[model samples]
Target: MKKSLITSLAAVLLLSATAATAQQKSMGGMQDMPMGKPATGQSVHMARGKVTKVDAGANLVTLAHEPVKSLNWPAMTMGFQVKDKMLLDKLTVGRMVDFEFAQAGKGYAITGVK
Candidate 1:
């Protein structure tokens, strides 16, 4: 009876370990990588830009930004969606800012601005 109990316990442990590994694999190996997106666990990219325009009603801000090395984006003028409209409260035309953002959907969305 003792041997049978020990054997059954060992089998249960092995099965549990195997199932955990399989579940992780099914979920994309312990990390999710969204399509056309940067690698997981990487820091969000930061860049410096000057605000060129603000449209609070539309929840957009246009910026003339410097190059973002991590994202390989060049200096240019572009409009970005504000994730939180309050982040746009202090932004105005011609104000210099240090900001962070991530690519979302088909455009860039500002994660922060200062």
Candidate 2:
């Protein structure tokens, strides 16, 4: 009975390990990525959108943007943190823009706008 118990425990351990590995892989190895900071050399995502709001005090700009193919994101209106407050100067309510951004912490940060 002891031998059978040990075998069952080993099987459970093996299954647990397999599940953990699969979850990590499915997340694209983000398990090791840090939160609250942008990853070094992260890919830039581009999108076109109309400025819905620009809050310079908070260094944020809200956009009603087109579908972002790089991130497989559907068209949506969302707020993005700017890399710097100066970026906010370029944004105005009701203005159309082409922008570049990178993943930042649990959100996205705009790197440039045109």
Q: Pick by lDDT: which candidate is best? A: 2
The local distance difference test score of each candidate is 0.66, 0.69
Show the colliding residue pairs in model 2: none
Model 1, 28-80: lDDT tens per residue? Answer: 52442322333433346678999987767666777788976665455766677
Best by TM-score: 2
Model 1 per-residue lDDT at 27: 49
Q: Give the TM-score of candidate 2.
A: 0.65
Q: How well does model 1 score by local distance difference test? A: 0.66
Clashes within 3 Å, all models in order: 0, 0
Looking at model 1, the pairs that clash are: none
**Model 2: per-residue Cα lDDT over 2-56, one tens digit each:** 6786555545434543553454457562423222233567777788999986666
- Candidates in order: C-alpha RMSD to true structure: 20.4, 16.5
Error of 1 at 102 (Å): 0.8
